[model samples]
Target chain A: MAALVETINLTRYFDIGRGQRVHAVDDVSLTIGEKEIVGLVGESGSGKSTFGKTVVGLHGKTSGSVKFRGETLPQSYRPADFQRLASKMQMIFQDPYSSLNPRMTVGEIIAEGLRLHSTLDSKQVQARVEEWLVRVGLQAGHMSRYSHEFSGGQRQRIGIARALILEPEFVVCDEPISALDVSVQAQVINLLGELKETLGLTLLFIAHDLSMVRYVSDRMAVMYLGSLVEIGKADAVYFDPKHPYTEVLVGSNPEPDPELERRRPSTAIVGEIPSPVNVPQGCRFANRCPKVLEQCRSVTPQLITLKDSERQVACHLYN
Target chain B: MTGVMTSPQTIPALLEVRDLAVEFATYGGTVQAVRGVSFSVEKGKTLAIVGESGCGKSVTVQSLMGLIPMPPGRITAGSARLNGVEVLGCNVINGKDIRGSQIGMIFQDPMTSLNPTMRIGDQIAEPLQEHRGYSHKRAFSEAINLLSLSKIPEAAKRARQYPFEFSGGMLQRAMIAMAIACKPSILIADEPTTALDVTIQAQILDLLQDLQTETGMAIVLITHDLGVVARVADEVAVMYAGKIVEQGSVDDIFYRSAHPYTLGLKLAMPTNDPDKQHKLNPIDGSPPDLFAPPPGCGYCPRCPFSMKICDSRPPENFEVAVQHFSRCWLHHPQARISPAAPSIPRELYVGERA
Candidate 1:
C-alpha cells in the first residue's frame, strides 16, 4: 500500500510568556496509507487536536517534518503554500457552529474553496456546490439557508460538503461528531464512511469517542500527554490493547448495554492527565496507570513494533 | 392519561411529575419545550432522561427546580408532588423550599457553573450555609469532608484553592461535593460528565453511584449518551421534541424497545459486539422544529415506521410491558406489527492497513 501522509517525529509547541512552552505534540510519528482511515483517540488536553492541526498545517510545527504523498510540506505554512495545497488537502473542524461563517449563505461557504483554488466562474461553482449538497443528503434549496437556520446535524453535513467540494485526497477531521447529539452522531459517521468509499479519500479521524473511532477506522492510535502510546489494528487495539493506558482506556469506555455495564467492574483511572505544560518525566501515564512499574516513572518508552505482531507500543511493560 | 405507567404500584414515588408542560416565549413564537412530559422517581433509584439536544430533558428538570426564568419561560401545565405533597405551583412546598434543599442540580460545564471568584471550599459551603443554616466554620469543615467523599485527593488543600486551580475532572468532583453538600433528597445531574474524558467520566459516574448508595438519595440524570444512561439509569425516559416518547426500565428500553424512535436510536449506535455486525441504519431526518412543533408525533418525519395517525395526532402512552409505556401509533392494537428493537450494530472494517 502507498503511504498517503507521513509524519516523522512531528512536534508542535506554544511559547507562553516567561520562557515557558506548552508541548502540544512531542516527537510523534505516524503514517496514513492510501484510502485508509486512521483514528486518533485521546482524552482532552492530550494533544490529539494539536497533532491533527499540526499535520494539516493549521498549526506550525516546531520541529520534524510532514510528508504528503512522498513530498515534504513546509514547516510553517505561508499563503502560497496553503494556496498550492488547498485542492489536495482539507480539514473538517470540530465545532460545526463556529467553523462556518454565520453571516454567509451555505452556498457561499461551500463554494469558497472552488472560488479560491479553481478557475470556475460563479455559475459553475454554484452548480458544483448544489450537486455536492445533494450528494451529502441535503437539498439544493438548502444552499441559500444560513448556518443558524440548520440544526447541529445539518450544519455538520454542510461542513462536510464544503470540505469535499475541493475533492481533496486527504482530510483531517478534528472531533467532527463530539459536539453532536448521540442520535445524530451516527448519521455524520455514516456519511463520512460513505463519502470515503466513493471518493477513495484517506482520513485522519481525530475524536474522543473510542467506540465510534474503532468502528470507522482501519487502524487506531492512542495518545497521552502529547505522545503516542499505542497504535495497532482497530479491533486488536480495542479488544486486546497492549499498553497499560490503552487497557485502562478501553476498560473505562462505557458501552450502551445495560446488562454488560452493570455486570462489569469499575475501571476508572486513578488521577487526571498530567498538565501538558509541565509534562512529567518518564512515562506520562504512570501516575494513573494501575500496572505502573518503578522504571515507568523515570524512563520514557519508545514506540516499538512487537515481535511476531504488527502492533506498536510505547511502555516499559511492553519493552 | 399522560405516563400513568411511570407510577409503579408497589411504592410511592419520592418525586412525581404529572402532565408537565413548559413553554418559552421566544422571538419566533412560543417554543413548546416540554410538551406534556411526565415521569416519577422513587427513593434510592436513578431515572435518566435521554434525548438529542433541544429535546426538553433539561427543561423538564429545570422547570421542576424552578430555575427557568418566569417571563421568557413558563410552566404552562403540570403538577409535581414530593411524598404526596404539592411541590409545583407554589413558592414553597410544605414550609420547605425545593430548589437547593430538596432538589439539588449540577450542570454540564463545571467551570461555567462554578464561581471563578470564590474558593472551591467556599462555594461548596455556601449551599450548606444558605440551606442548612450552618455556621461559616461548620460549613467550611463539612465542605472539606464532602470533598473527601467525592474522592478528591488532599481534600483540605484542594478545597481552599479556587475553581481555576482544579482540573476538569477535579472541578466536576468539586461540583458534586457542592451539589450533595446539603444531602438533598433528589440530585439532578444535567450531563455532569459530558465535558470530561471517558476515563474521568467513569470515575465521576462511579462516584455518583457510590454517593447514591451511601445517602439513599434519588437521582435524575439527564444526558444524550445512551452509554452513560445504560451505565447509571434504573429507569429511562426517552424524550423527543419536548415530549416523553418512551419510558421504561433500562433493560426494557435496551432489549425490548417498542417505539420506532427508540429502535432507530439503538440501530444508529455503533457497537463492538461482533455478533451484531451490519451497516448502521441511521434515523433519516432531523427533529421537528419546536417554534411551531408538529401537530402530530414529533418523530413522525424521522420514524421509518411512521403511520397515517402519527402525522395527524399524537398517540397516547400504550403499555407495552409492566411499567413500560411508549407513545406511538404503532403500539396501537389496531396498528400494524410493532418494530423489534434491532440489536447493536457491529462495525466491519473493509480496508487493510499498510
Candidate 2:
C-alpha cells in the first residue's frame, strides 16, 4: 500500500546562538499508511512533538523531505503550500483549554475549521458543526457554551470536533487526552478509535502514556533525545522491547495488577533524563542504562533492523 | 499483640473520618462537594481515594486538613479524628502546628507548590524553621540532608539553585523533601505524580513508598488513576459524588471489586499488553452536579447495574468481607432490585473474568 504521508530523513535544528545548535529532531524517517494509527511514544524532550509538528508543517524542516500523496513538500517556508496542506492534515494540541480561544463559543470553534477549509454558507456550516458535535458525543445546545464552561473531556471533544469537521485525511493528536481525568481518558481514547475507523483517518498519536498508546496504535515508535530508538508493531515493541531504553520505559509503568506489580522486574533506566542541550556523544540513554557498555559512551548506535522482522532497535547491544 | 485488638481486628483506625460533608458557596449556587462520606486509614499503610474529576476526592482530603477556604468552601458536618484528636474542630493556630509537624501534604503540581523566586534550600528549610525552631544554619544543613535523602544528585549544588533550574523529576524530589521535612505521622499526597512522565512518576512513587516505610507514616493518596492505586495503596476507597462507593484492601478492590463503578473504572483502563485488543468500556453519562446532588447513588445515572432504589434513596454500605464494604444495592436484600432493563450488554463486560 502506498503511504499517505512519508518523511525522508527529516531533521529540525534550533540555532541556540554562538555557533551552537540544538538538534530537536535529527534524521527521523517515518511513514504513515492510510487509515493506520501510528503512535509516537516518548517522555518529555524526546522531540516527538517536534517531529509531529515538522510533519504537519507547523515547524520548518532544516533538511530532508516530506511527501504527502506522492507530492514533495516545499523545503522553504511557504504559507500557501502550508495552507493547502492544512486542509488535508489537522493537529489536536495537548491542552484543550489553552489551544481553544476562551472567548469563542464551542460553535465558533468547530465552525472555524469548516470556514477555513470549506466554502459553506452560514446555515451549511451550522449544520455541519452540529453534525460534528454529535459525532464527538456532545449536544447541539452545548455549541453556545464557552471553553471554560465545559469540563476537560468536553473541551477535548470540542477540539476533536473542530479538527474532524474539516474532514482531514490525517490528524496529529498531540497528547490530546493527557490533561483529562482517568475515566474520561478512556472515553476520549475510545472516541478517537471509533472516529478513526468511521472516518478512515490516519493518526499520529503522540503521548507519554505507554499503555494507552500501545492499546490504540497498530504500530509504535519510541524516541529518545530527538532520535528514533525503537520501532515495531505495537505488540512487539511493548511485549518484547529490544532497546534498553524501551525496556525501561515499559517496565517503569507501575502495573495495574497488584500481583504483577510485586513480581515486575525493576526498570534498568534510573536517574533523571539528561539535559537536551548537553546531549551525550554516544547513546543518549548511556548515563542511566543499567547495561551500559564501554563503547556506548563513545560511539552512537545506528538504528538497525534485526532478522526478517519489522522491528528496528538503536543500541550497542543490537550492533 | 498485647495492645492489638482481637481476631477480626476492630481496633480504632489511625484516622477515622465520619459523616464528612463540605460545600462551596458560589455565586452560581451552593455546591455540595462532599456528602456524608466516611472512611479510615490505618497506621503505616496507604489508603488511596480514587475518583474521576469533581468526584470530591480532593475536597474530602482538603476538609480533613482544614485546607478548604471559608468563603468559597467549608466543611459543614464531619469529624476527622487523627490519632483520637478532632482535626476539623481544631483552631487554625493548632491546625497549623499539626499541619507540618503531625500531618504533611504534597499537592498535585510541584511547580506551583514551589515558589519561583525562592532558593530550593530555603523552601525546604521553611517548614523546619516554622515547626522545629531550628536556626538558619542548622535548617540549611538539614535542608541539604533532606535533598540528599530524596536522592537528588549533588544535593548541595541543587539546593543552592532555584526551582526553575530543576527538572520535573528533580522539582518533585524537592517537593517530597519539603513535604517530609517535619517528619509528620500522616502524609497526604494529592496526585503527586500526575504531571510527571511515566518514568519519573515510577521513580517518585518508589521514593514515596520508601519514605512511607522509613517513617511509618500513614499516607492518604488522592488520585483518579486506578493503576496508581493498585501499585501503592494497601487499602482503596473508591469515591463518587463525595461518597465512598467502595472501600477494601488493594487485592479485593483490584481483583474482586463489588461496586459496578469500580468494575467499570477497571475495565476502562487501557491494559499495558499491546496484543490484547480489549475494547475500553467507559461508563456512560457524566458525574452528577454536586450542587444539586441526587438523593440516591451519584453514579446511578452512568451505572449499568443501576436499580430503581439507586435513583430513589441512598443505599447503606454493606459489609462484604471483614473490612470490605460497598454501597451498591446489588448486595443488599432490602432493595429487592431486579436486573437492569435489557441487562448490561455482554460486550460491555467483554474481558471481565468470572
Candidate 3:
C-alpha cells in the first residue's frame, strides 16, 4: 500500500504568556497508508487531537513537515492553500453541538465545502448535499432542517456528510462518536467503516476509547505527553501491548462483562499526567510507570521497532 | 426486636422507592421525565440505573434529593422512604439537612461540582460543620483524613490547595472525600466517573468500591456506561423513556436479558473479541420525544421485534425468572399464540463466561 499521508517530525507548540510554550505535539512521525484507518489513542491533554489537527493543516506546525501523496505541504496553510487542498483532505471535529454552525441550515453547511472548492451551481450543490445526507444514513428531506432540530447523533451525521461531500481521500476524524450515545456510537462507527469500504477513504480516527479504536482501525498509535509511545497492528497492540503506558491503558479499559470486570484485579495507574508546559526531563511516563527503571528518570526513550515484530515501542524494558 | 418491626428475614430495605413518577411542566408540554420507577437499595449493595441521556435515571434521584426546581418540576406520584420514613412529598426532609447527613451525592463533572473559590479542605469540611456540628479546626483535619482515604497522596497538602490546582483525577478524589465525609448510609453517585479518563475512572470506581466495603453503605450508581455498571453494581435497572424497562441481577441482565432495549444496548457496544469484529447491530432511530411521550412502550419505535400491541399499549412487568422482571409485551403468555411472533435469539445475549 502506498503512503497517502505522512508526517515527518511534526511539532506543534502553543505559546502562553511569559515565554512559556505548551509542547502539544513534539517530533511525532507517522504514516497512513492508502485506504487505511490509523487509530490514535491517548488520555486527555496527551496531544492526540493536536497531532490530528496539525496533520490536516487546521493548525500551523511549529516545526517539521506534512506530506500528502509525496508532495510536501506548506508549514502554514493560507486561504489559497486551504482552498487548493480542501478537495483532497478534510477534517471532522469532535463536538457535534458546537461544530456545526447554528445559523446555517444543514443543507447550506454541507454544501459550503462543495461551493467553496468546486464550480457547482445552486441546483447541483443542493442535489449533492441531499445525496451526501442520504449517504450518511440521514434522509434527503432533512437537508433543509436546522441543526437544533436534530439529535446529537443526527448532527454528527451532518458533520460527516459535510466533510465527505468534497470526497476527500484522507480525513481526520477526531473523536467523531465520543459525543454520541452508546447505542448511536455503533451506528456512526459502522457508517464510517462502510463509507471507508465504498469510497476507499483513508482515516486518522482519534478517540479515547481503546476498544472502539481497535475495532475501527487497521493500525493503532498510542500517544503520551505530546509523543508517540507505541504504534502497531491494532489487535497486536491491544492484545500484546509492548509499551508500559499501552499496557496500563488497555488493561484499565473496562470490558462490558459483569463477571470478567468484577474478577479482574483493579490496577489503576498511579499519579496524574504532568503539565505539558513544564514537561519532565526524562521519559514522560516515568512518574507513574509501575515498571520504571532508574535510567528512565533521566534518559528519554525514543520510539523503536522490535527485533522480530512490526510493533514499535518506547520503553526502557524493550531496549 | 421492636413490636412495630417486621421479622428478621423480612427486614425492610435501607432505602425503598415505590412507584416513583416525576414530571417537568415545560412551555411545550408536561415532560414525563420519570414515570413509575420503583427499586430498593439494601445495606452494602450497589444498584446501578443504566440508561441513555434522557432515560429518567437522573430525574428519579434528583426528585428524591429535592434538587429539581418546583413550578416546572414536580413529583407527580411516588414515594421514596428512607429507614421506613417518608422522605419524598414531605416538608420535614429539607435538602440541606438530610441530603448530607443521610444521603450523600456526587455528580459527573468534578471540576464544576467543587467550589472553586474555597480551599479543597474547607469545601469538604463544610458538610461536617453543617451536618455533624464540628468545629472548623477539627473538620479540616478530618477532611485531610477523608482525602487520604480516597487514595490521594499528600492529603494534607492537597486539601489546602484550591480546586484549580488539582488534576481532574485529584479533583474527583476530592469530590469523593467530601461526599463520604458525613459517612451517609446511602451514596447517590450520578455518573461519577464519566468525566475522567479511563485510568482515572478505574481509580475512582475502585475507591467507591473500597469505601462501600469499609463503611457498609448502599450505593445507587447512575450511569450510561454498561462496563462501569458491570464492574460495580450487584443489581441493574434498565430505564427507557422514564420507565424501568427491566430490573434483574447483574448476571441476569448480562447473560439472560429479556428486554429488547437491554439486549440492544449490549449488542451496540464494540466487542473486545478480535475474531468477531462483525458489523454492530445498532438500535436505529432516536428515542421518542418526551414532550408528548408515546402512549405505548417508549422503545416500540426502535425495537426490532415490535408487535402491534407494543405500539398500542404498554406492557405489564412479567417475572421471567426469580428476581428478574422485564416490561415488554413479548413476555406476555398470549404473545406466543400470536401470529409471526419472533423469538429473541438466546445465543446473541449469552455473553462469554469465564
Best by lDDT: 3
Candidate 2 CA-lDDT value: 0.85
Error of 3 at B334 (Å): 1.8
TM-score of chain A of each: 0.98, 0.96, 0.98
Interface RMSD of 3: 0.9
Residue pairs with colliding backbones in model 3 are none
In candidate 2, which residue pairs get closer than 3 Å at backbone N, Cα or C atoms, i.e. clash? none
Judging by lDDT, tell me the better candidate of 1 and 2.
1
- Output the lDDT of residue B14, model 3: 95
| DockQ, every prediction | 0.78, 0.65, 0.81
lDDT of 3 by residue, A222-276 (tens): 9999999999999999999989899889888988888888778886878777899
Clashes of 1: 0
Could you report the Cα RMSD, in angstroms, for every candidate shown?
3.9, 3.3, 3.5
Compared with the true structure, what per-residue lDDT tens digits does model 1 show for residues B1-354?
233343334357898888899899988899999999878999999999999888999989888877777878888998988888777766333333767777888999998999999999999999899888999999999999999999999999998999999888899999999989888999999999998999999999999999999999999999988899989999999998999988989988887787778777877778767455556777877788898889999998887667778888978788777888898887666787436523333223211110
Candidate 2 wrongly placed segments (more than 4 Å) = B1-10, B91-95, B273-276, B334-354
The sequence of per-residue lDDT tens digits that candidate 2 reaches over residues A174-203 is: 999889877788899999988988889999
Provide all candidates' interface root-mean-square deviations. Answer: 1.1, 1.8, 0.9
TM-score of each: 0.95, 0.94, 0.96
